[model samples]
Target: PVRPLWAAAATAPPAGAEWVWKATNDVLNDLYAVLRFEVQRGPLSRSPSAVSHANQVYPKLMPFLRWWKQQPDRPPLYYATLDVKGAFDSIPHQKLLEVIRPLLREEDGYLKCPYSRWCGKTGKARTVYGVVTKERFGDVEAVRERGRRLGHGRGSFAVFMDLVEYRLLSRTQLLALLTRHICSHV
Candidate 1:
């Protein structure tokens, strides 16, 4: 199961809060760690402008800004911070899974469905989890556009998943699980 950790929002109203999930005794934590390691070390980290940690931002951005200031005809430089209150909800789950599918395939031998032998409410061994719904919110670009507008230009299409309840056994089911989760949170 997952535990929730809440913190007061930095700039939102006093009643607002932000949260993240912390896994405890999760069977998939090892897989998650391995996936995170592989993803961080892979192409994602190779981007010249990619800065994962807060400390890296100052070290990375300051020099570039300084160099730009010294240039003959430098365009105006601007920096802005975003309020990512509902960031996770704005991303499409299907597209997110697709982006990570290739990476997931790379770990094929190491990736096995943890709920392969688990039973659902049907009282039978279930190979898949979650239900499919025809309820469509909007397109990926539309969702991203809303996120960009809400976040003041910065956006991402990454969706968080609960590995225990909605195992990655089937893409369709996973999408439904993620969609449901996002809808509830939003």
Candidate 2:
């Protein structure tokens, strides 16, 4: 959720766009706060046995578990874990657009994920300018190479995740349930 102040300042606001801008700003702030908190908390404990157990019980649970543990105070040693059902894919596209539109400067503005590649579908390659690069589109490998070249120093990854999460998690709530687990002694 790293917005370029210069970009926001340079943009000419549309008529009566204050409400939209304000809402987008709020969402961005929330997303930033959540991510910062998670990173500061660091990764959760994941012993080999525990991971093996999760893998055996639910094959797809490992990824989710890894993601969950990376969140701030996610394990809640003294509280039960809370899972937001269908967290992704529930976010409204319009809301995401509102948050991203101002940040885009070029004519295309938003990054275009062609329908062909929308669902991991592949077809002819296309090119799109993004916050990270300005060049012709090549194959997926080229795109990945460009990304690696850019690295993660400029907050591109954060912006990408923000856009993605905004698309998912429509109605979300956090509930704290007490648990007997404690790790202070460990």
Backbone clash total for model 2 is 3
Q: Over the stretch 120-173, how does candidate 2's per-residue lDDT look in tens digits?
A: 133222222222112323344544443443334333221121223111111121
| Cα misplacement distance, residue 150 of candidate 1 (Å) | 37
Which candidate gets the maximum lDDT versus the true structure? 1
**Lowest lDDT block of 10, candidate 1:** 128-137
Writing each residue's lDDT as its tens digit, candidate 1 over 33-68 gives 334434565785785555656778988877777777
Among all windows of 10 consecutive residues in model 2, the one with the lowest summed lDDT is 173-182
lDDT of 2 at 10: 47
What TM-score does model 2 achieve against the real structure? 0.18
| Residue 106, model 1: Cα distance from true site in angstroms | 1.3
TM-score of each: 0.35, 0.18
